[model samples]
Target: MSEDLSSKLLGPIKLHLRVTWESQDSEIKEYIEEGIAYIDGICGESDYSVSGLPRILLKAYCRRAWSGNTSMFEEDYRRQLLRLQHENGVRRLRRKRNE
Candidate 1:
């Protein structure tokens, strides 16, 4: 993710995690990066802007990570992950057809 995008997401992520202190800003930023990368790996690269399903999943991923439940995140979010994968596949097909 770009630095600008990361900065934009940090505040929302902190809010979601109920983090009122700035002490863990760097750690939360790392979680954001990891969440984005994990999502991209499973569903392909996406917009991951501050809204939409991708962002929702990213926030959930971070929550799970923070709570030490990262291992169960995939199982818990299996349906959404599959949906994202399908959507990304369709998008890739459309792009290829256009190309």
Candidate 2:
């Protein structure tokens, strides 16, 4: 898929990003969320996004945590072990110390 970003006055800025074609749709979203959690643990919430999170942060953090050497996330898409990925998911990931 190609997306053309443009301004009324400015012509365009074309950004080409990777696209993943997979059988597991819901699993992938959950996978990204798991990666985000791992990344958050590493980065400690600096300039996080307004919905309060961004997938790219997880990407970059994975770049850092895995020493830029592994694709652990894509290979290891997370699942709700113990019902963790609820609306309480973020809260649960945050409570590591409290636990």
Candidate 3:
């Protein structure tokens, strides 16, 4: 993610995490990066709007990571992950066809 996008996402993620201190900013930022990687790993590269499905999943992933329960994240979010994957696949197909 770009630095501008990361900074934009940080505040909402912090709010979702209920983090009222700057002490964990770096850690939270790391979580954001990890969440992006994890989601993209499943769904392929795509744009992430602040309030889109990808962003929602990213927040949940970060939450799980923050609480050290990442082991179950895939299982817990299996449906959402699949949906995102399908959506991305369709988008890619459409882009290829258009080209």
Candidate 4:
């Protein structure tokens, strides 16, 4: 696959599934698209980059959304999401103080 198309294949949506490229069927793609859409609905218009902590949390959230069951896992992800929000709030406050 060309670089452009390969990147396009995974653009905006990141999948943590173990399927090979050959086995990436429509069903799996639909799940990923749904997960990505779920995250985007909450996170707004970010590029969904892999660097930010919030983005990482969103990925975990997407994974949980795709899994369908396991509320325990969802709770854990929610806790982490809250922690990230708290940490970001602290950083914003510190920045404001120093300004």
Evaluate all candidate structures by whole-model CA lDDT and list the values in order.
0.90, 0.36, 0.88, 0.51
> Candidate 2, after superposition: displacement of residue 74 in Å?
15
Q: Please give the distance, in angstroms, between residue 86's alpha carbon in candidate 4 and its true position after superposition.
A: 1.7
lDDT of 4 by residue, 1-99 (tens): 133432443533344544456444554455445544654444333334355755565455545655664356435666655665566567777879999
The weakest ten consecutive residues by lDDT in model 1 span: 45-54
- CA error at residue 61 for candidate 4, angstroms: 1.5
Across 10-79, the per-residue lDDT of candidate 3 in tens digits comes to 8999999999999998899899888998889988875765477898898999899899888888899999
lDDT by residue for model 1 over 1-99, one digit each (tens)? 887777889999999999999998988899999999999999998877748889999999999888977998888999999999998899999999999
Span of ten consecutive residues with least summed lDDT in model 2: 5-14
Error of 4 at 92 (Å): 1.3
lDDT of 3 at 43: 83
The alpha-carbon lDDT assigned to residue 70 of candidate 1 equals 92
Q: How would you encode candidate 2's per-residue C-alpha lDDT over 4-82 as one tens digit per residue?
A: 1111101110111122443433433343445455554544433223222333444443343434444654334334222
Winner on lDDT (1 vs 2):
1
TM-score of each: 0.92, 0.30, 0.92, 0.45
Evaluate model 2: give its TM-score.
0.30
